[model samples]
Target chain A: MATLGEAKQMILDPAIRDWVLLPIMVVMLLVGVLRHHITVLITGTPKKPQLKAVRESKALMRGSQLRAFRNAIPPHAFASRKAFLTEAYDQGKYLKNPNAPKEGVPAPNPMTDPDMMEGMMEGMKKQVTNMVPQMLIMGWINFFFQGFVVIKLPFPLTLRFKSMLQSGVDTRDMDVTWVSSLSWYFLNLFGLSSVFTLILGDNNGNILYILGLHHYNEPIY
Target chain B: MARLDFEAASLELQQYRQSGERASERVAYLASRIIKDGYSAKLKDDIWPFYEQAVTAALDVGDFRLADECIENLKRRFSSSSRVQRLVGMRYEAEGKLADAQKIYDAILEEDESNILVSKRQIALLKLRGLKSEAISALVTYLDTYYSDAEAWIELCSLYLSVHAYQKAAYCLEELILLQAANPIWHLKYAEIMYTLGDYSLALKQYCRVIDLHEDHLRAMYGIQLCASKILDNGEADGTTEALKELATERILATEVNQCTIDSIKQVVREYLSVA
Candidate 1:
């Protein structure tokens, strides 16, 4: 067995071992040592995790418009459109044929009708109205919450709620929006509680490894 | 014929001199004409002396608009004149077009970086634009490379305070106090920072020092009373409270504290006493 100094020296060597592998090993060792005691210290084993506040509120908004835009694209538009366009746009002329005449037909005008114009106006209004609230909330959240100076929060619950929102959850479900909203609230509560217990699950994959129950762990990827 | 022409010219000049505003307008118009007509030889021989006389007369009467026009015409005639840019910077500053002023100042500084007035105006424009850190850095570099000016130090202190850099603000004020110890504002600001940092006793002492340095420092007097009350409320030691009360009494008797000052001091005193 290597001496403690030798073990530390061996761990630090640039050539002998993979640097990435060492951090991973350190994290695993920390988690195994500390995982059992985290719940006891944080939740005290007797108290059930409170769900009342979690079920009543809306989730904090996260992520950006670009992510949503990419996710919303329909899958079929690419394959069929590409196949049809490739043949028509090829540089080489069509194969030789005897006395062949090309036929031309004009496509119907897209934006010439009154009903279509009305619908377009309505869509534009809806788009603007939707964007206003999103921009306002995002601006407020960015300014107040992300200013260079840290603010003293009046309550820990607000911090917990903010953390839940920052978890990047999409809090909308099928016909009933309440289910998703309740789930978001609970997610925030659980997140804060875990943070209190030193078990925060970060969505950003930042270097802040949640200090485990009794020891340290590498950050969860 | 020559005598009649000379008499008519003298009467016209007299009329222009009698009406200052009219003279400015006439000077600007003639300068514009001379510049536009490429009448350089005529300007040198006759028009320039008349133009120089008009510009000096306009400046004497504080007619900046006419002065600006004259200077612009002069630049139009003498495009290589270095003095024209400095005058333009001053005109922009006087007009309160700070962005334009800054641009002109920057141009002047590029040609002559040691120009004090241009550097000062440029820093002021940076502060107005909310470029606080940049203003601070520029002024610091200017101070480091050249002799210090009291106005520059004061502006630097204000920038530090605006940015909530209390420690740096205190240090800057300390520098100024060393240079001119009688400034009550510096002492007040230093005391305010000390209060914020929970050095209530030290803050009270600083406030007392301000009062000692300037008997009419009502703000510092009020601050001392407030700090004393805070000390009482926090259940701190008795030494600071006795010292503060004594200073307040001294100022109250000496200056015959104005009701406004008394009211404000009482308000702070009440707040601390109630909390205590």
Candidate 2:
């Protein structure tokens, strides 16, 4: 229960700022920019989907749009479309596998589906690529710069933040604003995201996809 | 950014082109000017898009030689690019070799059915050949895949109108209205089509909707009066119909028109209001 008067302040050596803080920030920035470019290069141009596959999804979209905007059209046009789409839906005309067994059809084996496997592999590759660099940077920072306070936040913080900002340091009664090297690495990771978006375009890193918003498939207009 | 010199109008115009604007006429003029002045060589990689843009602009102004030269330059670089190939198709279309242009578009579509640019080009080619039915079917197919494209909806609507399929045209206009409810043009077109289809009540509603969005629309005012009179002829005249008719006439007479046409327009409005 240290009050504001009892809070301890430590003078950080300028050598820590020059060697640890600035270098970490610079490395983070360069790694971010490199990650963006590498993601672009790895993504290349997407392969074109099959014509029937495109038509199937689009036809389903058309049906849904027509249903949603049905009031816009006259009765006759709406009626005709309703009948046509109803027939198509009943016949499973837009299904990718319309001729498949209808009664008690076995669920597809995940490992046997090439598209499923490829998608999982792609996700795993991205995860590993994203994680390896960060883990390596964390280990490198820990090995060389641990057991030292790297930077100081200007504003005062409560004792609650001491464990967070002083993770690698064992000192008690130190001010919460003095952050350890590991915490500095985290600070760089969070702060450089905006810089990444500034240098790259807004859609960099497929933020929505990474957030699992793709499965929700929100109406994009 | 220093302002370019007064003599550098072409270079200034090039700024708009590089920034992806449609300064087609100036781009055409400058592209030829750049080649003549030996400045095209300096553009290097940037010259490709300039030539592509100039090709269409040159064709638009009927400079076949300049268009051909631009097309030639594009082909030398991106010989296999579908984009460059589409330019060649457009060049052939301008040359009045419709079949040749059709062949090129067909080849592109065969390779990639999802090529939206080539799909549109093929439809335009069909329309240019005055094959209305073919154009309508092609556009309908394109719209199926790109159900949200407002431009294609407008085109399909106009095509249906030209073919005298008022019901179908009305459907297309309804789709457009749903797609872009803010645009008064779609409401006006829908009103006109409903009027053509003899659904005067719906027509009047859509016309009033247009008025709600855009107060000074002359055609919509006229459409309101027309629909009011038609509804009156059906013995469905009400106080609101009469008021709408008077309002439309008052607004129409208040609007500005040329001196030569004002008297006749006033007379027409007077007779229309009297009938309603």
Question: Which prediction has the highest lDDT against the true structure?
Answer: 2
Question: Cα RMSD to native, each candidate?
Answer: 34.7, 7.2
Interface RMSD of 2: 2.4
Tens-digit per-residue lDDT, B128-180, candidate 1: 77788999998887654332365677778888888888777766665555445
Worst 10 residues of 1 chain A by lDDT: A54-63
Taken over the whole model, the C-alpha lDDT of each candidate is 0.51, 0.79
Q: B3, model 1: CA deviation in Å?
A: 33
Q: Best-fitting candidate, measured by TM-score?
A: 2
Against the hidden reference, what TM-scores do the models get? 0.37, 0.71
lDDT of 2 at A107: 79
Candidate 1 error regions (>4 Å):
A1-221, B1-84, B93-103, B246-276
**What interface RMSD does every candidate have?**
30.3, 2.4
